[model samples]
Target chain A: MSRHARDDNVPLNADATSSRDLALEVENLRTVFHTEHEQIHAVDGISFNIRRGETVGLVGESGSGKSVTARSILGLIESPGEIDPASAIRFEGDNITEYTESEYESIRGDGIAMVFQDPLSTLNPVYTVGNQIKEALSLHQDLRGTAATERAIELLEEVGIPDAARRVTEYPHQFSGGMRQRAVIAMALACAPEVLICDEPTTALDVTIQAQIIDLLMDIQAERDLSILFITHDMGVIAEVADRVNVMYAGEIVESAPVEPLFAEPKHPYTRGLLRSIPSTQTSGDRLETIKGEVPTPNEPASSCRFAPRCPKSFEECSEVAPIPTAVGDDPDHDAACLLYPESMTTDEAVAHHRPADDGGEQ
Target chain B: MGRWEYFLKRVLLMVPIVFLGTTVTFLILRVGPIDPAAAIIGPSGDTEAYAAIRDSLGLDQPLWIQYAEFMRDLLTLQLGESWVVVRGQSVWELVGVYGPRTLWLGFWSILIPIFVGLPLGFYAGLNPNTLADYIASFGGIVWRAMPNFWLAVIFVSVLTQSDALFGFSWGDWLVETQIVTPPDLSGLWEPTQFLGALKAILPAALVLGSASMGNEMRIGRTAVLETKNANYVEMAKAKGVPGRLVVWKHMFRNALIPLVPVITGEAFLLLGGSVLVETVFAINGLGYLFFQATINGDVPLVGSLMFLFILLSVGINILQDFLYTVIDPRVGYDGGA
Candidate 1:
């Protein structure tokens, strides 16, 4: 029933030897948020897996539901916001959604944990830093008095907070933004959860700080053999850390493949556009080539494929019906949701003897 | 010169604002159309007797001359005498008799609310969307919407009925028909007791405290909620901090900083309205004196009492501004500019 418990009989490193083993399996997980006005399909049947000791980057533009998908995996979605019954988020062999209230108590922090964005507002202003960290340790593990205090200071030091002994007694407001984020990360790692979910942990920091955080996370992941569900919109961060990349658009995964292949061959028009959008030092100008149209709001459901309106290769069928994920050129793990693929195409395209306008037609 | 100059500028500005407010209150009282001279001498009294009373009270003078004399007397603090009492006494002397009751009531009422409301509000905020939060918010809303007078009436009725049910004596604490004159109190401790005297004050506190409690709890709950959403709270949570520490240590302090001014302002407002509470309870507080002077058409006394109220509110505002600077450090001490 536990997500992280090892099975002695089963062979480890079930997949590629370099990748440890499967840590979390999210199969067709759909999260629907019921707002006052309408039903928002925040995560539309998204599926992915994070291997042990490996980072899987859920990369997409903001509002593509990357953060919502990460939160849903941890059962952190606020109620009245409906999460679909069809979704199965299995950590190890145990299904997370099936866990009763009491069972979830053990799992929420110890089994899996999350580090949120915005370091500035992450800590409560009134509490001493030492008391806060000490409380976290006590919540997931049993430590009291001097033991808790000592552990709290050690955690602070682990997160690169300077003067750990004295700073532990300081307040959140007294810490810099980078230090606050580190403190937050320290809290998430308190119980050494099997899987750690980080949502744009570096997006709020300066570039140097961002690099430092990325390095720290990577170092910690290696040290603990922790599976990380790294959620970010930055392609650069994905290239730096992720072994597998899932490109999401309009609350659905448009493409998922090994990091190398996904970036090299891309396949989906949306994925290609995202790659192009990544700004490099060479691509310097005020005009960064964006993935044209904005991501659709959840309030308004898309007509066909959620990304079709924004896709340069959009066709008649793209407007009328949604495209389901299909294999992109016989690769099992690599899937693309697009009308251009023959298996998932509209009748209008077949009659026209049409291929997806193959060339990047001058726009 | 610079500091004094700034202080003088503010004081000068306060003059017109306070004067205009007092004049409006005075005119409204005068325009009620129940002639003071007629009321004073009575319908059965001879015309000459009424004329003589009018002359002595200066009611026979022209409106401009009367207004001028009233303003002049107000500045000098010579509030003059109350006209409603059988043997009319000085307004200050009347206030001296009843002022402590109102002050005592206001103090207790404000204190009880702070003691009870804040902790309830803090707990409710910490447990957001839970039954506790719902109960606190709903209960607060109901109490806040209830008029203080209505609450007072309800409490009195309940206490009376409960006493009847038990065949026990429920004291007539709210409406004390017998009035006691103020005693001389030069002793330091005597001042404290005089300030905290129960007879005039208890009912006042009950009325004001209950109302302020409901409002303060709601404010406290909101401040806590806003603080709970801060990044530091999540940081604490990430550290595996227990729920109590997260709430009390991190969220509670920042949340409380913003509430200091609001609590202070409400305290002063309660003090200002203690007069009304005292009147309802039948206590001869300053409110009773103010009421008597107005009823008897003692314009000078009314004007002076109004000045005291204005002074109290302004003083509280200045204190609140200074306290706000000390508590949050974001606000400037100089009038929060």
Candidate 2:
């Protein structure tokens, strides 16, 4: 991956900052999946919070624990998956992480609903779209019979499914990929949940539909004051919707910042590589830059910086010691986990001062 | 539009499938060494008598004309008279009389597995890897492995034997044990006529239903297990649906989708089993008559019986296809479209 020099002059995007009520808080989440011989540390001690009406993006490549983090929050993790006891998932001041299955049942899709990546799988094929949506309405909202049916139709209409009255009677297979996704979104928002975790909800759609879905989510989030944990591998998507972006690598948050700064001046080399790799009109003629190595499965606890093997700017210390997430740059919100930010990274002058002569890029 | 259209298409497709099945049987019967004419004339009849029989019966006619007549008779349900087993009796009339008994046996057989196997399997599935599952699974295997003929014989012999301590036969004991409000000494008198009737067929039905019951049990468990993990099921649970509703509303129907074909396909298996079961139980059902007709070279009787079996099997398969479309909307019969 080529080194991306920070654009020092771009002003901050003010829309990305909002000091609102904390809707959901996740602390020290370490999700591990046990196999016969090893435990896959899928989400390793990651923490973040979404304020009411804010969209927090957990951005990562496949196998980088984004989906696991979402599942863990919902208490949806099944057998072989074990969340570390220290993990705390707080929603509106309630630490729901310790809830029993029945307790979780009351919260899921009521307090915090989710929209999965594949809408076809998310909606039951045997049931009509209206019936499935009514299920959620009845379960969490106490709307029943005609009332639930009417609410389902309304929700479907609100999500932009045309002729909702007619389409509600149809099955999932009868709808197009995008329409199915809309139905799923409608189902998630049926009870007017406070927190919505969208796990790669647009990854299966075409570019236009993806944009539409993102827009629909943002519009709904605004009207409902919904706090969203939008998980995706698409940095472009994170750019479009996320207020605060958490860039995850190998089960750890490598960078966290307001989306604009994270884009314009990514501190962690991994974050820089992710930003540089997105397809851009300016880089149309250039071969796309790619982070060269796969994200390790992390079967063993992190002994050193996991990204050091592929990090272009990784020094000898990167292979010897792991980096913890430390504040980077002047923004109090921004943090990056890299040995380069031994303390809270302060400024570019310090970065340049610390850089070795041979390894510093063209900048 | 797709559902009704698909159902109509499948119903129509049944024509060629049944026709082809009957046609193959016709060709085999016609080309085989057994001459119906000789069988009709018998050993004492002269050569002239044989030729007269052949000519009169249209056995001398060309093969295509015979096949056309056969097809016509099948369509019109004008199956010819029986030759030897019940000489000169109309095959249709014979089947009409005998069909109900076998059907009764079949009904119980079907009901037995659906009630017994499916619930056991589902129970096992609900508590998979538990002791309950293992016991149910093991019992199913043991029952399935017992041959119907052997099991039928054993049941009949065992059921007919007198319980010396009680001074009543096992069958009588069963009838007496039924939860019927009866006169205290009703065991010797009426002992519930329905249970008495059930006693007569229960051994055979149980034996016949055993294999299918076992099969359904194993399959039911698998279907439940597979469907519980399906994405839709997960979605239902994630919706905070009560666990019971999740199983009943979401999992049950999806689980039954796989079992529909397996259950409907049991009809064909039952037909083959009925012959042995009928012989062992001494039930004068169609299967027993079929066995007798086949042994006695009752050509017309055999042909009609075989064709009827074909019709029933084809009908069963059509039912299976229809059930599939009903259970799972995605699986439509798009054949010949």
Candidate 3:
């Protein structure tokens, strides 16, 4: 790789060493979509960071703004997608907001790459896998026909494609579901980006294929020291691979903590509900506990805490004002937007008073 | 039976239908309010003179007898003479004379529409939201809305004043005939009259071309747009495929497959519409003959023209099916084909 000059135009602070070590830092990012009727704040002031050589999973149910947050970081949102001025997506110490579309192209596949959910739709039907991969390689690397093709074959092999030489020549449709996804991964890995955004990449695959893909991604991440922002609704998958977890609800990150701490004691009621809802043999009830109500659409601006309506531990204080980030315990890293803490609790402790009775009744 | 077998059986069944179409045409012409024998009686015939002429011309015969005689003559390709217009010209000879001109005009005119319209539509589809799509779409609507007669008048008026259109000017019709004749069939490159015939080809082709091309462009735009939004296209975009390759290879090839039937239908439409176009342009093509027949109340000529169109329609439909099978293998004769 060439020792290319870093863009001088990026806003920087020499003393702000904290942001430099991170591959991507999204600071209070909010994305709103303007429709004919109203403005929807899909990603409402969600903040997270992915460091080099780490995998961070954003877990949420449908309409959780998990995908929107990832797309916003990549600048993939089209017209009507309104990002607030306050939000800053700092990629490798460079605020991405400073780059125009043409300049954004430099960071898109090179600085940070993204792999979409559907593998079948991700590869152009007309071009061979080799051609598609080679095109991306050539874009970031200056290589001609044969050299680019050789590199493409190497990528296919790296992604564990059998008969990579011959399979590279085949079009996307000819490949099975698993192989197409492997091919997509191969394309994403071709440029050797600093960070990779996998948006539910394994969600479309079967159980066996999903395991293979997850393993492939892990292997690639180890080899490249790549930071990955993995987005999925599956907590089990998060438990399997993620070092850190960000739990989002209705377009806002409700709780974020280290994986072990989050799995041990979920701070937010919404997070507890989500973890309980995951189907498992040990939780041998006829019905799994579900988070009540649907995720609110952006059309209706969320007031107070967005998840307050669905939170089982909601009290009158929950609806009075919007929840702010409050430490659940002494650990500064472990935080949630809930009034569960004693000093933070304002007004009648109606829900907390019912807690002991609820526990006894359940037993 | 499979679709092909069923289709073949249906087509075979249409042989009788075609024969019926001809028979009905003959009967309708016979029952028309004009007298066929009036011209034969020298236009000064008394009632008794008309009766003698009718007897000789077989007009006095019973309806069944006349039908039987007509059937025999049709089978033998010996159509009887027209009573008016070409007073002594055998219907077969007259058809032989006029059919070639009409067929030639129809063939070229249809080709003009397909070649111009499809590409224009494709370009428009590729560049949606750009000036190209807007211009092509607007042009398509304008041409489609204009009547063939109105188009013909404008084309003639413009061509006559300019004396040239796209580097070709109106020439005498003698060139096509000389080229088709025996001595010239030996491959002498007769460029003079051929170029001249091609000159007026513009107006006829333009009128037919505008109508069919406009319709084809609209369909092409839709196909291209739908294809552009296909999942594979998104993949291609992510894969960093250039815009041109994405449009041409990914979207275009797939999109064009669905348009095979529409293109074939346009061919037939242009061919039929050319008749009106030719009359309006004052081109001495088969359309002129049909127009003259209608104006002069030449029922036999009019009936034959309508019958010829039915045959053309059936032939074009068959060609369309064949093209569809060729374009898409998934569309089989048995089911989706």
Top candidate, metric lDDT: 2
Reference A-B contact fraction recovered by candidate 1: 0.39
Top candidate by DockQ: 2
Q: How high is the DockQ of candidate 3? A: 0.20
Which candidate, 1 or 2, has the higher TM-score? 2
Candidate order by decreasing DockQ: 2, 1, 3
How high is each candidate's TM-score?
0.69, 0.87, 0.71
Q: What is the model-wide C-alpha lDDT for candidate 2?
A: 0.81
Q: What tens digits encode model 1's per-residue C-alpha lDDT throughout A1-363?
A: 111111111222234442226688787777788878888877776777787888998988889999888767766566766667656788867888776545655676678888888877776554566766666677777787899999988998888888899988776667888998898888787766999999999999999999999999998999999999889988889989898888888788878877888887888899888888877822667877777779987665444678777889877767765655556654456767676764444555432322222322111
Q: Choose 2 or 3, whichever is better by TM-score.
A: 2
For candidate 2, lDDT tens digit of each residue in A165-217? 99988888888889999999999988668899999999999999999999999
Alpha-carbon deviation at A160 in model 3, angstroms:
2.6
- Rounded to one decimal, what is candidate 1's iRMSD? 5.7
User: Each prediction's Cα lDDT score?
Assistant: 0.70, 0.81, 0.72
> Which ten-residue region of model 1 chain A has the weakest summed lDDT?
A1-10
Q: Where's the lowest-lDDT run of ten residues in candidate 3 chain B?
A: B178-187
Off by over 4 Å in 3: A1-17, A300-302, A329-331, A341-363, B1-142, B145-199, B239-257, B286-337
Compared with the true structure, the alpha-carbon lDDT of candidate 3 equals 0.72
Least accurate stretch of 10 residues (summed lDDT) in model 1 chain B? B176-185
